[model samples]
Target: MAGGFRRSGQQRQPKLQGKGTLEKMEREGPFKEWLGMPDLYRHTLVIDGDTYTYQVEDAELPFAPGDKVVFRYKEVKSGKWIDRNSLGTWIDPSTYNQ
Candidate 1:
């Protein structure tokens, strides 16, 4: 998963705790790359009935589909696994530009 703000259930409080004024700014930070190459293997997080695939290429980084993985382009750029339900949305190259 991208290294940024992640949504949690009501049981867990927000990570970026502060007044409303600064909360917005705090939410925005480094634009995490989610579509390079797989690095470290992170556990799978199924969200909204979608089975998202995650894996590690090197051994210490984490990455997901559409999201740039940790490794640079010099290595394997893409890998694949079966999406049984195809629940998650697939992002095209054009969307990444925005």
Candidate 2:
């Protein structure tokens, strides 16, 4: 799509990943404890002084509480933690301001 829109397949559609780069968030790393609620999808991440609300899949990773971090989404006017990756997992935003 030229409009930067992705045609999300059916919700039940399976994701065929061969486990090279994008592995399941649960087995990714230390932040695995922040896995999102699969059925509820409501997750919250407070960084700096702002609260970000976003939905995540069952096995996906949600934001974590930290001191200083970099969030790629500056336009969260929609009151939702915008998904920059669309993989149900946002980037690792634990890096402090440098």
Best by TM-score: 2
User: Which ten residues in a row are the worst by lDDT in model 2?
Assistant: 17-26
Local distance difference test, per candidate?
0.29, 0.39
Mind sharing the TM-score for model 2? 0.33
Model 2: which residue pairs collide?
none
Instruction: Tell me the number of clashing residue pairs for each predicted model.
Output: 11, 0
Give the per-residue lDDT of model 1 (tens digit) for 40-76. Answer: 3433433233323333332322224333221111112
Error of 1 at 88 (Å): 13
On residues 73-92, what C-alpha lDDT tens digit does candidate 2 reach at each position?
A: 33435763535444233334
Model 1: lowest-lDDT 10 consecutive positions: 17-26
Which model scores highest in lDDT?
2
